[model samples]
Target: MRVAYNEQMNALSKILGEMAGLAGSAMERATQSLLQADLSLAESVITEYDQIAALSHQAEERAFALLALQAPVAGDLRSVVSGIQIVADVDRMGALALHVAKIARRRHPNHALPEEVNGYFAEMGRIAVALGAAAQEVLISRDPERALRLREEDEAMDDLHRHLFTVLMDRNWSHGVAAAVDVTLLGRFYERFADHAVEVGRRVVFLVTGTLPSDEDHEIDLAHGR
Candidate 1:
């Protein structure tokens, strides 16, 4: 019975990894479409959203089934619960990517961002992609330390987002209101995508260390002589 239970856990972990990869790839493609005004690539990201959603549903189903059949205890139980939360976070990440793609499509043949601010969006996309990659690595390695370190990446995304607003608010800004709206939405999509990746990392830490992120932070503060 124990052997069977472990096998099921392994299978669920594999599914979660695949889901993370899909979300990351979707975001990367979406970023390309947004910055380059590539309607075809945007369409591809939008089209693939259903697959990401389906994987989340499958992960939830497997987790519940494991609970019913295995009645997992301690670490196993944490794994099942965390698996559910991780799937939710990963699924949301994919949806955010789809939003980015749709914005690109909405403004097809015309760049969504002004030339002066284009570099800001590019950097935001880079940070978001890096966070997604880190989320996948933390999940697979179950490294609590790596998971905790993702918070810094999230801060970088936040900084980019704030910087974007400064550009938009400049009195000399020439882009019309419609363009500003598009940039606002695009910045939000990237920021939220990074937020979800950080959430996934926290879930991984909980799964491995059985300690919530807040509690882990408290411990770190104590160790640092704070």
Candidate 2:
């Protein structure tokens, strides 16, 4: 029974790795399409949503299957639970990519705005790609310390998110309504993607420590000066 449980977990990890890769590619392409105003890639991102969602559901079922069939306990139980979390986070990341694509489609022909805002969007994409890679690494290794460090990177993305919003709100900057709305949604996509990655990192910590720590005990505080 123990052997079978381990086998199921091993298979699950492989399937999840594929999902992570597809999701990462989706985000990367979505970002590129938005920045370049390439409608084709944006459309591709929208079309891939079904596969991403399917993989997430499959992951959930496999995790629950392991729980029901193997009655996993202790560390093993943690693995199953964390598997569910990892996939759900991955799926949310995929959704953010889709949202980015939608924003990209809406802002077409008008072009991206503020000139300087382009740099912010570029950095947001960079951080998002990095977040996707880090999430994959956490699932691959299940290392709590690595995951903790990954979560810390979210602070930088958050800073960019807020800065872009401030630029959007500036009365002097004339992006017009359509462009401003696109910028706002773009910022939101990056912020939410990073947040989902952080959630995966929190689950990684839980898997390693065998205890899911409450948010109340988290002591790391950001200066919020950005």
Candidate 3:
């Protein structure tokens, strides 16, 4: 029975990893759709989000089922509880990706980003993708060391988000209110996406070390504009 329970726990981890990959792919394609103004890509992203949602639900169910049937304790209990929380984060990431794609589709044939600030958004997209990949690695390896590194990676995303606001606040900005709103929301999406990735990393650290992150760490997580 213990062996079977361990196998189920391993299976839960595998499903979580797969969900991470799906969310990451969604964000990458959403970025392409935004930068390139590809309606087809955007449409595909919107259509495929149901799968992410479904998988999230499946993972949650497995977690609860294990809790009730196996009555997991100690580290096993933590794994099951943390798995639920991480899946929520991953699901939200997918929803944010869908928002990006919707923006692209809404503005079809015309790039969502203005030419002047295109480079900034492109870089933001890259960082978001990289962060997503890092989150996946933490889940797969369960390495607290790698998890610690995600905080530094998150700083880059935070810096970019701040820079985006500076551009919006610039007096010489020629883009109209509508464009400004789009850029503001886009920056937010990427910023929040990275935050969720960092949150997942923190969860991994907790699962591995059986120690909660410092209060300072929680503050850092909340400081970034959610």
lDDT of 3 by residue, 1-226 (tens): 5787788888888888887788888999999999899999999999999998999988999898888889988888888889999999889889999999999999988888898888888888898888888888888899999987887888888777777777887888898989999998888888888888888998999988898676343222322332
lDDT of 1 by residue, 1-226 (tens): 7998889988888888888888889999998998899999999999999999998899999999999999999998999999988899899999999999999998899988788888988898888888888888887888899998888778878777777777877777899899988988888888888888888888888988888787232111111211
TM-score of 2: 0.90
Model 2: CA > 4 A from native: 112-114, 213-226
Superposed by TM-score, candidate 2 places the C-alpha of residue 137 at a distance from the truth, in angstroms, of: 0.9
Global lDDT of each model? 0.85, 0.79, 0.86
Highest TM-score scorer: 3
- How many clashing pairs per prediction, in order? 0, 0, 0
What lDDT is reached at residue 194 by model 2? 80
The TM-score of predicted model 1 comes to 0.93
- TM per prediction: 0.93, 0.90, 0.94
Q: What does candidate 3 score on TM?
A: 0.94
Question: Candidate 3: where is the Cα deviation over 4 Å?
Answer: 215-226
